[model samples]
Target: MENNLLNLRMTSKMLSRQAKRCQKEENKELEKLKKAISAGGTEEARIYASNAIRKKSERLNITKMASRVDAVASRVQTALTMQQVVRSMGITVVSMEKAAQSMNLEQISAVMDKFEQQFEDLDVQTGYMEGAIGGTTALDMPQDEVDMLIQRTADQDGLELNAELANIQAPQYLPDEAS
Candidate 1:
């Protein structure tokens, strides 16, 4: 895949160079055509214009071919990248399988249970902390005092507090009958 992609990139570069050469030749022909047209000779001007138009058309075709080559190169690069990712993932999967084979069901279950207990403990501690903080702080303070505290903290932290607590509505509680 890498070799193929490299070849494609090289081909794209060569095509682009060919296109640029054609464009330069076309420009030269166009300059000659312009001079002939300005010289006031109808027959010569007609011949030059026809040749220039043909050369311009060829240049356009070359440019189109170059664009196609570049697109193919881009696609090849994308494929190469995807191939690398898939190869890495395959390696990871094999390693995971090997590791899993070494671990017993009991061990896995114990680890999972340990993690669950830790998380439950953390949640309980978080809830307790929240309740304690709420009871001692804003919940027990006057609205103006809370606002003043918030403003002072913001000022100390170099933050501009533009939020209005009044604009935030509390969650509406619905009775079981309403539900």
Candidate 2:
């Protein structure tokens, strides 16, 4: 199971790389499309557009395959862990059975009494209630407090992401914005 998990992870990584390469090729195809459009080559632009669309679908398919492989790997790992736990529990049960055979009836009765008394002495519910008495969760926040937090963080971010750079990619193909 461990080996199977490892193989699944490796396959997922390989597929992810394949997806990356597909995206790289798709970008190149899009660039060719822009150039073809700029040169007024209608047939060439159509071909490049078709190729770019195919590459995008290929990338998406590869990504989906990788996700499925990862999910399989996770299940295999969980099963392997459960198998180990069950094996350990079986050994523990055997040990307990052997020890039980050595204990006398009165000894077992005394142990059971002590266990019951200890359980009765522990106030688990009260301890938990005390811990949670003053606890506050996000859902407990008042509307006014939520509004204050939003206003406090309402300032514009200093970071700049110039998305216009994508349009200006083919400078010769696109007219200047100022013009």
TM-score of each: 0.53, 0.58
Once fitted onto the true fold, the runs of candidate 2 whose alpha carbons sit more than 4 angstroms away are 104-179
By TM-score, how accurate is candidate 1?
0.53
After superposition, which runs of candidate 1 have C-alpha atoms over 4 Å from their true positions?
104-179
| Whole-model lDDT per candidate | 0.62, 0.67
The most accurate candidate by TM-score is 2
Tell me the RMSD of model 1 versus the true structure. 23.8
What digit string (tens of lDDT, one per residue) describes model 2 on residues 53-89? 9999999988877777766666675566557656655
**lDDT of candidate 1 over 1-179, digit per residue (tens):** 77876886687678768777777776777787788878877787777777777777876776666566555655555555556556655665565565568787765565556556655665665565555434433234567555555555565698755666433332343233265
**Top lDDT: which candidate number?**
2
Kindly give the number of clashing pairs for every candidate. 0, 0
Worst 10 residues of 1 by lDDT: 168-177
Residue pairs in clash, model 1: none
